[model samples]
Target: MARPRAFDEGEVLDAALRCFWTRGYEATSVRDLASSMGLTGASLYNAFGDKRALYEKVLERYASHSMAERIRRLEAPDIAPRDAISSFFRETLERALDDPEMKGCFVVNAAVEMGPHDPELRAAALASLGEVEAFLTRRIEAGRADGTIQNRETAQELARMLLGVHLGLRVLARLRPGRELLEGVVKPALAALDPHVPG
Candidate 1:
């Protein structure tokens, strides 16, 4: 009978995720992944297929635990839509500021680095981004009904705009990891949706 592998798979994947997150797909060699993941080169290939395959898994892991979860919270019925958006941005800013290296979103990094050539990575990135946009659209519609959001645009348009703003904020956080700078970027973006505040 074939023997089962010894190492904890989840632990190894977590280690690989961190390595890919830090170095990115292009710069991170399989050797780096193997070392960080506590596996031999042969073992890494045997388990995860290859570096690209491992990175795809890591990106999905990040999406599930981070990006998708945040979007899921935005859809919660208890919170006011406007407040949910505000809280989301505040949380995002805090997390970005807290990161010493300011690594930004791994999925965003992968999408850019991989470009259009990698259909799988591109599709994964777009699907995650679209989920957040769709969630925002739903929340905006709720806000309209309850009179929380006073924006003139349709929920779909507003959601797209917010998605763009959020992505821009993520990029800025990597470039300038200061609270003031990040806050300055988000304040007006949120105000654009505030009925009490003029655009």
Candidate 2:
């Protein structure tokens, strides 16, 4: 029988995720991953296949849980839609803005760095962003019904605008902008959805 692996797969993947987060796919070496996980390159290949395969696993791990699940949780029965959105952004951008490391986003980072060159990676990135946009669209539609959001802007347009703000905010926080200035960006963007607020 084959010898059992020395390290935990989940732990190794977690380390690999951090490695990919810190160093873009092309830049991160197998040695880097093994070092991060306290394993050898041979072991990493045995456990997770080649670098490309490992990166794909990392993407799946992140998307399946972190990205997709957040949108799903917001759509849950108990949470108010607008309140859900507030909580979602409270967790995503607000935390990104305040985080000392300011890890913008794994998917966003992959999008900016590897997306243009890799169609598969680009598609994955677009899908995750689309999920966020769709979530906002649903909430905006709900807001229209509840009167939390005005009906002036089409839900599709407003959702796209908000998604753009999120992407921009992620990139913005990478520069470590002051919390006040960063928070200022949201009020104006949210104001645009208000019927009384000027365009």
Q: Which RMSD values do the candidates have, in order? A: 1.4, 1.9
Candidate 1, residue 102: CA error in Å?
1.3
In Å, residue 35's CA in model 2 sits off its true spot by 1.1
Winning candidate number (lDDT): 1
Cα distance off (Å), candidate 1, residue 107 = 1.2
Tens digit of per-residue lDDT, candidate 2, span 98-189? 66877778888989987989898888888888889989999889877877778566899989988888888888888865687677767677
| TM per prediction | 0.94, 0.90
Residue pairs clashing in model 2 are none
Worst 10 residues of 1 by lDDT: 190-199
Model 2 residue-pair collision total: 0
lDDT of 1 by residue, 1-199 (tens): 9779989988999999888878778889989999999999999999889898998888888899888898787668788888888888898889899899888888788878885789988999988888888888888888888988887688999889988988988889889888989999889888888889653
